[model samples]
Target: MVLNVDNYHLKSLDNLDVKCDITKVRTEVIFRQSNEKIGHGIIIQSKHFDRVAVFAPFSGIIINRIYSVYVERIPRDQQWNEQESGTYWFVPSNQIPELVPISKYSANDRELIGPLVGVVVSKAIRFAFVWSPSLGEGICENHENLVIGGWIKFMAE
Candidate 1:
């Protein structure tokens, strides 16, 4: 399914409910003027998963607006160095056409948000995403009772 931000209010993370419909996620979108368009560094934080930051150049994103969430399958050839700090990946402004959407979420409904389903190991690193009916979603670092197809990254904290 295609998600368009125009349907939702472009509000900042501070204006949304942290624990209700939006769940455990908190966001920050830092915009810069690029050729008369708005580019952004989008940070999505949740006590349950690893912190994810995405940069979109000339993305036309407005600060403090709520956008839908879509998780796309990362390309196997994509260079993601887990051992390195300050690493980033870039996607075109029209991400829907370029990447395969594996999951989609609407921030306005807690019921639609996906649960942590499973874990995967890349380069000997374990990643986990967890979800609970009562506790919501979280990242699981260590291998525990994992099934398959979950969300978030497990951290060592």
Candidate 2:
């Protein structure tokens, strides 16, 4: 998905209302064309599965990688109160155990790593999917650009 500049609304990383360690965050690179680096982004995961937030470093058109596919477009207003309303885009055919390199996983992340489905960018937010070989499936959202810090803690309602 591509978000035009005119319709885009920028969310500030410093102004994030969620409580998280600004220093402990991780950065992911957002590419413009193939191999062309565009910007950076931050991924904010909620302790709860209800909601996730992505922050972009700058204002620009957001594009999803080919590995990721568009499942649906949800309007901010139509969001449901329950976690089930959130979209979890996953493709069974794309499932591959240990798709992410083992070196990238920490001791605590051993059970959390799996094959990546792809990335979807909408409104400056990137929604990523990775299927767990043992578990089931999980999704993460980060800034359209590369994320540069550690996980920020947010109180999930």
Which lDDT tens digits does candidate 1 get at residues 96-124? 21221224433432333333321221111
lDDT of 2 by residue, 130-154 (tens): 2212222334444444233212221
True lDDT of residue 57, candidate 1: 40
Candidate 1 least-lDDT 10 residues: 1-10
What value of lDDT does candidate 1 attain over all alpha carbons?
Answer: 0.31
TM-score to native of every candidate shown: 0.29, 0.20
Quote the lDDT for 104 in model 1: 43
